[model samples]
Each structure stands twice: as C-alpha cells, then as structure tokens.
Target chain A: MASPLPQLQPEVAEKFRSTVIPCRIEMPRLGLTFDLRTLTLAEALELMKIPDFTYLVPRPKRRKAASSSTSK
Target chain B: MNTFSLTHLKGPQGDDNTPGLLGYVLVAREDAFSKIAKAPKTGTTAGETAIITDNHTFTNADDGFAKVYLTLDSNMLKAAITGERDGRGLKISFEGFHPGNNAEALEFMRIVKNLGLIILVPDADGTYLQVGAEGLPVEFAPDYDSGKLSSGRRGFTVKGEAYANGMYIYAGTVKYKA
Candidate 1:
C-alpha cells in the first residue's frame, strides 16, 4: 500500500493507536458472543483456558428446499 | 433475548474508550485444527487438553501469535462478523495491507488466496476472535495495487474469505507447531 499516510485530520493522540477494527464472535456452544478487535494464536490459546471452550461447526441444516418453499 | 438495557451511562462506569486493533494477524491451514479444546458449557477448570497445533505445545511467554508488522498500526485492518448469511456457513470478511510487495511477499500472498484458513484476529484491548473458526475455511482475496504514477497508491489488499463463522476468543492457552 502507499506508504504516504492519508491526509487525515489528526483526531486521536499520536500515542493512541485507535484503529476501528470491530469483531464480534458468537459462541453458540455457550450461548454467548462478544465484541473484539481480532483473534490471534495466543488469544485462541487464552480462550482454551476458559475450561470447555469448544468451537465446533455443526453441519449445515439440509432443509428440503422444495418442501420448505411449498410450506412458505 | 431482550435481557439487557442500553441505558445511557452517566456515572463512574461511563468513561468508555477502547483502543483499536494492534499487532499482526495469525493464519493457519484449516486442517491443522481438529475437534479439540473442549470447554464445558459451564466450568472453571479446563477439563481435557485444548486445541493442539500440529502436535506442538504453545506457551504463555512468546505466546502462539505470529507478531508481524502492520500498516498504520493495524488501522487499515478490519474483521467484519456478519453471522451466517448463507446456509453453508458464516459469511464474513477481513481485509488489510502489508507494507511491501517484495518477491517473497508476492509469492506468499498469491498462494494463500487458495488456502483454506482460519485466521486469528487480535485487538489492542488484549482480546481476540477467530475468523472461520466455526467448522469452515477461509481464503484470501489478494489485490495488488501498484502506485506507478505520482497520484497512484501502492498497496496489497488481502481480503479473507467471507465464509464460516468467527467465535468469541477468550483468554486461553494456545500451542502452535510448524
């Protein structure tokens, strides 16, 4: 990317690395979701420490399309 | 579902200013992970072993994150979680830029666009989340822009796959192996 910084009007202090990177993850396993900036290897490991933090992807529901459409 | 209230804050717990993203993003092959790291629906101590990375153990010190350089202190980085848009999986996206377009970087970015991946995104507040961690894989949309002209801007925009769901990553122990 162009190294020349965008001509942005300085808003926050230079010391503050304020980058609006929003991330919200849902833990259906625990019926919970939270907002964050990002997830890292270390952070993933940190979540493991929360006891039973299982992140499993359930198979997609193969609903019968024709039947469902008819019902609708 | 309507349990909490979004009342206006006016007391001591009103000062809410959080930092944005910082540091590097972590990406790995999807197959490298498995049905491990079983945390309970409710518990204090972790029952069994957590997710293992290529059979290697991760420690707390250097941690398991691959710290890389970021542009604008990772300001350009973004991880948008929009839940599952399609029946297949969670449709999501992530995009950012790396400073250089060297040969090594070029080749790596080229190949990674096809790799099934789960990316770990970190935040400046010390929290994190994993994209495509919910039983699906993500690929990258690498776009290389060369600012050849005086007004042109050079950049390599890496937009991760908008498939699979991301999970709330808590503070836990991680072990990554090459």
Candidate 2:
C-alpha cells in the first residue's frame, strides 16, 4: 500500500518531470516451428494402406497458353 | 513522511530516458522468412541485443533487409503503441520522413505500398525501437507532401499501422542471415 503522503528527495522534487516513465513494452521472446513430418506421417501411413490406383482423379489438360493468347 | 514505490515503471534519478529515434531504419518483408524458428534475442531487460550471437531462422535467400536512410532531422522516424490487453492485442504505428520528391524517392514508395513489412528503428543510443512481433507484422507505405511556402519542405513520410503487441528495443545490430 502506498503511503498517505508521498515524499521525494529534495533534488528529485526540484527537477521537472519531463517524460520520465520507463518502457512498458516487452516482447514475448518465443517462436513456433511446425512439425510437418509428424503431421504428414500419419497421412503417409494411411496412404500405404490404400491400393495403388484406388481412385483416378481427372484433371483438365495442361493449357499450353494462358487464357489470353495475346503477344508475349 | 513516507513514499511510494514505482518499481519497473520508473528508473532512478540521472538515468537517460530521452525520447526520439534516429533517422535511419531497417526494413524487411514478412514472408522473407519461411518461419522464424527461433525468436530474435534481445540483450537487455527491455529487450535489446548484445555482443552475443542472434537466434532465428531468417530464411530469405536474397532480400534480407533494406536500410532506408533519412537526413538528420529532429524526430524523423518514430514508433508508437496503441490499444490495450483487455482481450484485445495492441497496435503499432510508425512514420518515417525523408526530405525529397524526385523520381528516386518515388521509386521506393511504389514498392512498399500495401505490403506487410517489418521495421527496425534505431534510437540515439545503441537500442532499437521496433514494431510487429515475430509471427505478426505491420503494413507500411509512404505519403508524399510538398510543404507550403512559409515552411516549405518536400518529402515523403512512410506510415503504417497494424494490430501488434507493442514496441521493443534491440541492444545491437540485427542479424539477417538464417
């Protein structure tokens, strides 16, 4: 608990209080690394259980030219 | 009579707590790293760097960071904190002005517009005033203005804002190599 009356040293009380507060900012010194190996390992194992050609996904033919056929 | 204690918030008398930052700044893109596998090490209690090695995964092969230099002007570059932690995170706003209006100046302005950025501001001392935490970053750009005849000055101010944590201090130079 703070005192009823705050008292400061004579020198301190004499000086002007110009922007005297300290820095309140603090960084949370921590970063994250994703474990893709562990996450995809389960999926990889699950893939091994499936037949080689269980489902064939049909994709559109690779377009040689972009939608626009204008000059390069 | 008695006195109250203002522990970490205030320092002892005669300590230098001066305000304002230097004119030069270091900036990098957010995606410049695959991921910061480790947080950058700050040397001081207030989070500054020391002579020790840095810890991080700065994965950018080409664009590590660009040092944007500004003329020696009072308060040329600055960073400010906003918002509170009542379930809402903080925000940071930075504005750096360079005195010029030529095409050379505008060339840099064109690139930073509306892109996520990482800013590192140096103080008069060996510390840095930084914004945008590791994973979270800021969006920055510039605004050009040619001053009036009375106090005419032609220049551009790089301004940006983001919902960030708060400002930080780095004791020494920043390491860009992963």
Candidate 3:
C-alpha cells in the first residue's frame, strides 16, 4: 500500500509544524478582508482590551426569591 | 559588487521636473497592477515608456519629500517561497514635509480612508515600486514646530502594504562613472 501523504524528513516536518499560522479576518459590513500574521503577545493583549468577541460574555440574570416564608 | 545612489524621486506619471527628494512626495491612486499584468521589464530603451494595460489612475497630492524608505516584508513571503502562495508584502514609508494646503491634506486623508492603491517611485531615473491595496497612512502630524522657524517644516508618516497578488518590490540599477 502507498501512503497518501508525501513523506517529509523529520527536521523538515518539525520546522513545518513549528511555523506560526497566519490569520484571515473578514468584515462583511465593510466588505474588507485582511490577511494578517499571527499576533504577538503584546498585540494580542492590546486586542483583548477591545470589546470584541473575546471580551463579550453574556451576563447571568437574577431571579426574585419566592415569598414562601409566610407558610412557616 | 554593484552599487547605486539615491539621486532623486518622482511621482506617478509626473514629468521630469516633478520635484524629487527635496521638493514633494506624491501619492496617486492606482489599480492592482499584478492582477492586470506581470512585472514590467527592466532596462528598456532610454526614451521608451512601459505601457501598463488595464491601469487605473487617480489624482495625487504632493507633499514635500523629507525622506522615504522601503523594505521587503519577508515574513509574508514564507508561504510563497515554499510554493504555497503567490505573493508577498512590501512596506513603505513617506516621511517629512511641510503640510501643504488643506486640499492636499484632505486628498491624502481621502486616500487613507478609501484604502487606495499607490505607487511610490524613489528615483527619477525610472526606478519605482508599486504598492497594491491600500497604502495606510498610519501617522500624520502637521505643524510640528508650530511654525517656529522661518523654514516651517512639518512632518508626516505613512505606511503602505502590497497585496500578495501583486509584485512586492521592483529594484532597478543605474551605473555611473565615478
């Protein structure tokens, strides 16, 4: 049987696996797409400050307690 | 080894007298030449002009050319060199100048807002580089010294990116007898 994937040297495979993947972001509203490199720690942190998806979380709602104390 | 000097700079479609390093930096809108055609051939006849097919042209705003710098964004080429992609990115900077009239500033601002393609020609002798996509004018400051000196020099900074489908850089060489 033949392998489906091409055989790569160990070092070559390691180099390949270690490379950072680029990021592509699309903004349909603006009709724009950006091809960007992986973000550095600093850049990621800066992005964290923005209220994007990473920062958005649904807040839990509080329910009123029932007035059951009258039965006691 | 071969060497060359930075003698003068020119604007897109500008005539020979279009001011160079000492005078003004020009930003004109252009189409993505890469999608339209291959890179222009280097070393053509002295008087011949390279005709670009399906080219898009726009008005330009001229600013004083204090200094200009260009560099290859090699990181963008990693995938392309490995035959995984087709293009890379180039970074260019246009710095220093007296803020021209409001119209010129507005024109440049419009280019930034619209993300228009531009060509940054760094030599008067027909050597130039085209930047595809929007040339982002990241930083701009006017009247740096508050017009303190009689010369009245203002400063501005613009950073540009080239699309992968277009040529990233076009380098040309000129020889002179020392």
Candidate 4:
C-alpha cells in the first residue's frame, strides 16, 4: 500500500526536530538573558514583520556551478 | 503581581494631590560606581594593592541622590509614565537667562558635563515607580527659545542620547493590611 504522507530523510527530520527546541537570547551589554520558546510557524510569520528580528536570520548559501573538468 | 484599581489611583497622601517628577542625576560613571561600592576594611591602607578587591560592597551611603526638582510639564510626565518616549533621544528644556543661573540649569550643566545617568521617581509618598536610564550624553542648545515672548517663559533645550538597553523600570507594592 502506498503511504499517504511523503517520506522525509533522517537528516531533514533531525533538522526539523532541532528547530522545535527552545533557545536563549543573551544581551551582554544589558547583562540580561531571556529564554525564548520555539515559535510555531504562525508565530514565526508574525515575527517576520519586525525588522530587528528578521535581521537575526541568516541568508541561504548559493550553490556552486559544475565545471567541465569534473566531467572526466 | 501588583494590581491597580481606581481607588489606588489616589495621590500618595490619599488625596487628589498632583505628584511632581523627582530627578536623580548620578555622578560620573566610574565615580558613581566607586561611591556605590562599600567602604574598604578599616585597617586596609589606601595605597595597598591587597586592599583593592574585585568584590564590591554596597551600603546605604552609596545612594546616588543628586538633586530633587519638580517637573511641572504634563506632556513630559505623561511620556515618563507611559515609557513611550524614545530612550535614545531625550530633550529637557529650562527657562533661564543663562546656564547655571538656577538649580535646574546647574543640574542640567552638570549632567552634560558628567555624561550622567538619571532616575525619575514620582514625588508622591508611598509611590514606588521609578524610571531610569544610564550613560546619557547630553548637549546644550542655549537660547533655544529666545524669540518666544508670548509664553513669557524663554529657555534652552538640553538634548541627550539615552544609552541603548540602559532604560529600566522598577515598581514596588505595599502589602494589604488585614
């Protein structure tokens, strides 16, 4: 029987699980640390509206092009 | 958690009294910290390197009570109460012919000179709300309102930059007596 849901690789599943863990934000200048719970997809969408919060996210790296020398 | 009600809105004296804002200007940063530190041991010599320790002791004498003045402006008061004013930008105006002519002027000059910190406490007895900011760099704009004679009060504005992440609020409450 065909599975109803698409299969996910183990690495992908591990990444998804790690995203659900809570994190701590440290402000050394203020000498304060705030514990932040994992955000739901909806909460992340809401946070995207904030400029400062959006700046914290890193951009994805670009893929390298294949070279003719590797074709051997 | 402290709860507020209409009944609790009464003045510190339990009447419809209007409380003024009391400003406490802290000394220069290092001096202020040193003042706040506890006194060294009685037998410790001033020049002894052993007397200098990383541990600090705080005492009541370290209270940084610099000056008390009445802040009469309603708009400023509202801004202080709501914390809506920008912590990075603060402007204080004073009416005087010259700087340092009055107590307020002197305090303003001192703040500008010292890169002083400020704590604003409501001048009402039993009120426990305090708003503070540290490491403020102040600039003086003398004769900011030289042409304004209609209001009868002329003054200059002292602009300052409040330190980022330096603003803090403290709220205290009294227990209800049975």
Docking class of 2: incorrect
Tens digit of lDDT per residue, candidate 4, span B1-178? 1121122233457565555533422122323432222212332333222122222111222222233332244212223222355634333322213322466765566555444443323333323222322233222233344445565444443433233222222321111101
Q: Judged by DockQ relative to the true structure, which candidate is superior, 2 or 3?
A: 2
- The CA lDDT of each predicted structure is 0.48, 0.50, 0.32, 0.32
Ranking, TM-score, top scorer first:
2, 1, 4, 3
Model 2 regions lying over 4 Å from their true place: A1-72, B1-13, B37-57, B73-85, B148-151, B171-178
Model 4 lDDT tens row, A1-72: 753432223333332332212343322222333323333444444444644341124335555776775787
How much lDDT does candidate 4 score? Answer: 0.32
Top model number, DockQ: 1
Question: Alpha-carbon error at A51 in model 4, in Å?
Answer: 49
Per-structure clash totals for the candidates: 23, 4, 1, 1
lDDT of candidate 4 at residue B158, scale 0 to 100: 41
Q: What is the C-alpha lDDT profile of model 1 across A1-72, one tens digit per residue?
A: 634422212221211221222233444334444432344334444554655443311234555668766684
| Candidate 3, B4-98: lDDT as tens digits | 22234456675564333323333443332223222444424321123232222222211111222222211111112222345434333444444
Candidate 1: misplaced stretches above 4 Å? Answer: A1-72, B1-19, B34-68, B73-90, B164-166, B175-178
**What is the CA-based DockQ of model 4?**
0.01
lDDT over C-alpha atoms for residue B76 of model 2: 42
On TM-score, the candidate that comes out on top is 2
Tens digits of per-residue lDDT for model 2, A1-72: 753332222333332121111111111222212111122334333433534311112234556876476766
TM of each candidate vs. truth: 0.49, 0.53, 0.29, 0.30
Ten-residue region with minimum lDDT total, candidate 4 chain B = B169-178
